[model samples]
Target: MEHHAPTTEFLGMTFNLSNVLMITIASAIVFILAVVTTRSLAMRPTGLQNFIEWVMDFVKGLIGSTMDWKTGGRFLFLGMTILMYIFVSNMLGLPFAIAIDSELWWKSPTADPTITLTLATMVVVLTHYYGIKMKGAKEYGRGFVSPLKFLFPFKIIEEFSNTLTLGLRLYGNIYAGEILLGLLAGLGGAGIAGALGAFLPMLVWQGFSIFVGTIQAFIFTMLTMVYIAHKVADDH
Candidate 1:
């Protein structure tokens, strides 16, 4: 069955109800996790606190590797938030997807090009904003012409390419994973023999999908920091 997204028209604009609902759920999950993780500050952390601290430390390291701590420290929260949110979003569809009356109501938001592209655009925009704020507008604009004036057009092209690749890479991986998983699910429902045959492949694919989702989250966060470093670093 081909399930279509439930959408609505509002203020002369179209909106995907499924995407909106999933995005809201993902955001709420991230928010609740953050609150729970920080609800108590312990001098000696354990359990969830320890886990979140470790994740934060990992994000800190990512920032440090890209730019000096003085500059990158400010982005620690951003990096951590991005990592956690995208990870949660990626994992949402792995368990199972929900389609109600030919409308897909639940899935990974990152599987949609609209969501991924918006995220990429936001990250790229933030990098430029920070670059201007740190380097001053004049100095930042000079970046396009530095080393050689002819590089300006190429640099402009690079920005567009970066945004397209960053967004499409995530969307492609997740969308394909979900499609295959859906097929496997259909196979599992066929009959006893089909269930037996599909079980192992489904299980294996689910695990691989988890791995891919985690990698994609990390890659997106890493690239975000790298882009910011290129924009804001003095030596760049």
Candidate 2:
């Protein structure tokens, strides 16, 4: 089994330099695009501003469809940020960066468990915060004990499982896609004949990977909206 070596280390931790650089670069690109897009808003939007607005509206509609507008409206920023960030990050790996030798860099950040899990944890924590705020301590506590007060243990387990699944699902899909891409790249490196044989298959895989990446981003955002809605809803 040939494994690509880690790029670099920092502060006693082994960090993949390429991944870190790619994430930083992707974040900056998104930030700049966002700033440029909204800098000159118009009554009749055009160019990048129009595209950005369209995407935002699309995300808003998705949220509205899942939950009431009042609740969904409040989460517009969250949904927009997640969708744009994930979309940009997913597309970042499409043009593999070249820095050292023929080594590929700039894989999707969400494909990494560390990145996906961090985002998932934030969503889970936000859900809990809103749950406590909206329902109050008393009702929040009561929610855990509803139907069967004696099942407090099971309720706690369920809460953790929900969050775990939220993170794991995104991680699994993105990671598997990344792994398949890596495997395809490996085939391309297996001498000249292998490289020639791998081209068509590689193209197919790359196209499929793009589709998978986009769907994963949408699913993650939808789930986030659902979780937050459930937390803040009166009937939950």
State which candidate has the highest TM-score.
1
Which candidate gets the maximum lDDT versus the true structure? 1
What residue pairs clash in candidate 1, if any at all? none
Error of 1 at 15 (Å): 0.7
lDDT, model 1:
0.95
Clash numbers, per candidate: 0, 0
Which regions of candidate 1 are displaced past 4 Å?
none
Q: For candidate 1, lDDT tens digit of each residue in 38-65?
A: 8887999978898899999999999999
C-alpha RMSD values across all candidates: 0.9, 2.7
Q: Residue 114 error for model 2, in Å?
A: 1.3
Give the Å shift of residue 170 in candidate 2.
Answer: 1.8
Which regions of candidate 2 fall more than 4 Å away from where they truly are?
4-16, 97-105
- Per-residue alpha-carbon lDDT of candidate 2 for residues 1-236, written as tens digits (9 for 90 to 100): 23453567679888876668767987898889899999999999999899999989988888887778876687898898888788788777654534355444557777677777778889988988888987798877787787788889998897688778877887787777767767777778888998898888889877987887788788889888888877777665
